[model samples]
Each structure stands twice: as C-alpha cells, then as structure tokens.
Target: MAHHFSPIKFDNKGNIRESVFSILRNAILDKKLEPGQRLVERNIAEQLGISRTPVREAIHKLELERLVTHIPRKGVVVTGFTKADIIEILVIRTSLEALICSIAASKIRPRELDRLELLAKQISDEHGKGNLKKSNQLNNKFHEIIYKTAESPRLYDFLNTLHEYITKFTEVAYSKPGRSEEVWLEHNEIIAALRNRDSLGAESAAKRHTENSSKAFLEMAF
Candidate 1:
C-alpha cells in the first residue's frame, strides 16, 4: 500500500495539506488502506514524493475524524468502527435523512424530479449488469440531489461527516446476495414519494431506506 501512491504534482491551486488529507481519506474509504494497518510516515512520504510533514499533518486530521488512531509505541493505524459506533451513526443518520427528504420533497423542482427518475433507472440497469460501483455512484448522486434540494448547507455538512465512516463499507453491503436489487427498489420508492411531492411519504421512505441499509451494513461488517 505504501507504493500505491504516484508522485504528487502540485497544481498550486489547492492547499497541499488538504490534497494529502483527501488522498489519504479516500484511500481509507476505498479499502486500499484497511483497518488496523499501520501507516508509516516515511514510506508514504517517499511514495507521494513529498515530505513527511504534510503526511503527518494529514494523518492528524484523519485521526480527528476517527478514521485513524495514534497508538502508543505502535504508531498510527487505521481505525475500524465497532458495532455500537455503526448503530449510533445509523440511528442519527436515519432521522436526519428523513428530515432532509421531507424538506427536499417541498423544494425539489420538476426538472430535478425527472433527473432523479433518470438516475434511478440508470442505477437499476447498472445493478442488473453487475456494475456495483456505477450503481453506488448513481445511488449517491440520487441522495446528494435530495440533500442539495433541501437547501441546508450546515445540515449537509453534518450528514457528510457521519457518512465518511459508513460510506467505506457500502460496496460490501451491496455485494451481499440480493442487497443491490433491494436497494434499487427502495430508492425508487423514495423517488416516487418525492415526485408526488408528498413530504410525509418521502420522509417515511427515506427512514426505511436508511434502516435497511443499517441492517445490511451490520450484517456485512459484523
């Protein structure tokens, strides 16, 4: 994994620290950097063709996000979520997501509704063809549209923080037999409620989707 990163090229536009942080964060989320894997600052620095300072800084940021841990004498390692952590995050996410869907149902425009339908159909097609990654991307796009339509920037930010941890294992959830098809059907229900502009129905569907996702993640992760 240390040699996985190519040489870093600075575009001089984005902050180097942030670039490093994002790279490391995505690697962790993508499972390229597995839980409990030790992170060697020197090796990472060499691989990215950068100094250890920014890598150290990035590790600290990931630590704050609870994606990494600084173990005494053992150095830093990736952190894995406990079952309790998963439950707590899902419980909060389910409620907040429901509210977000309710808000989106009221504010989403007709064009956006049509786009949602298009995305939903695409996801179903992708899943049928066994393209889980494309399906997941579309699924994320579907929810992101709802979050954007909700028009609550702060709420979106908070929800994303919760998502960082759970998002990593979503592929595993979808890989479970029949899970992807179930999720595709569930997303259609949510889209249906949104198209009808039924705030209550949208909220209920969103709630159920999250609950089912929680079960799938737990079954896969634990």
Candidate 2:
C-alpha cells in the first residue's frame, strides 16, 4: 500500500490536517486514487510523514464530500459516478448554463464582452496548436465570464459546485479526437449570439454547446 501511495509535500505554514485533506481530495479527483480502491490509513500516514489522526480526519473530509465511501468490510474506497449520475449532471448543466447565457446576453458589459472574445480566440488558437489543456482552461474561462456577468452570485456558486464535481473527469473530454476544434465553433456561436444581445439565441447556443459537451463526455465515460 505504501508503494501505491505517494508522499505529500506539505506547506510549512499550513495546518497538517487541512493539507492532508487537500492532498487526498486532489488525489481522488485526479483519479490517482481510483474508484473502489481501498485506502489504508496507516500506509497513507506513514507515506505522508504524518500521524494516523490527520489521515483519519482527511478521510472523514473526503467522505463528507462524497469522494469516498465506507463499506462494512471494505473500509474506505474512492467514489465513482455512475452513468445515470453523469447524465443527470449534464441535464442540469444544460438548463442552468442556458439560463446563465440568456441573463449574460442582457447584462454583459463591454469590458467583459471583450474579455470573452479574447478568451474564445485564445482557446481557438490553443486548440489548433494541439494544446488541449490550455484550450480547456480558456474554454472554462469563457463560460466563467458569462456566469460572472450574469450578476447572480448565488447561482454562480451553485453551478460552480456542480461543475467541480462533474468536470474532474470530463476535463479530459476535450482531448478526445476532434472535440477541441468542435468546441471552438460552438463557442463562436455562443459569442455571436451574445454580441447581438439576442437572449433567445444565446440560450439556444449555450444549450447546444452543453448538449455536445455532454455527448462527448458520455461517449468517453461509457
């Protein structure tokens, strides 16, 4: 088990338990700690140069986040989303993002609009260069701008939580064959709608973008 786990580098100023929790959470989200993989507290504590107490606390935190589960005999194992879970997330995202786009189309300021356009072009260029990771980050930035421009902090917070949970795995969806390029085109459509201040068109474009994204993730996941 020690061989399977990597030692965590802790920040000197950070609390041990919080650092442990962050490390473990990121490991789970990154899929290094795979679904159904048993977590050994002793091994983790030893590898991380920490006591079992902090490791236990970190495991508790992970459990709270639904990133890990405890079974009667299995102890704690990483959690994986089901096909149904993915589908439900996608459906919710499509609706919420469409609404966000509609609101943004009506409320977006010139500065924010300019930033969005720049991000779109940057994503397109990065995608053409086969820089999928940067392309995805820019893609997220573009949508995030719209969410911020919507002027609803609570709505953004809620959608952000949902996005975090599902996108941990689906971020790689853009790396699939031609998804990056397709996403650029979809982004352009969204920007065009927003530029025209066409609320309905913006909503439709966002819906279509999410639908295609959902399809890409589903195809890769299943």
User: How high is each candidate's TM-score?
Assistant: 0.82, 0.78
CA-lDDT, candidates in order: 0.84, 0.81
Give one digit per residue, the lDDT tens place, for model 1 in 126-163.
88889988888887888889999999999898888766
Candidate 1: TM-score?
Answer: 0.82
Worst 10 residues of 2 by lDDT: 1-10
After superposing candidate 1, which stretches have Cα over 4 Å from the reference?
1-4, 9-15, 29-38, 51-53, 71-75, 163-166
lDDT measured at residue 153 in model 2 versus the true structure, 0 to 100? 91
Which residues of candidate 2, in runs, are more than 4 Å off? 1-22, 40-61, 165-170
lDDT of 2 by residue, 1-222 (tens): 323555666554268887787777777666787788888899898888778998999899788767889999879988955667667877988999999999899888888888988898898788888877787777778888999989999889878867555455447577678887788788889888988999999999999998998888877767
Clashing pairs in 1: none
Residue 97 lDDT, candidate 1, scale 0-100: 93
Provide the lDDT at 31 for model 2.
Answer: 72
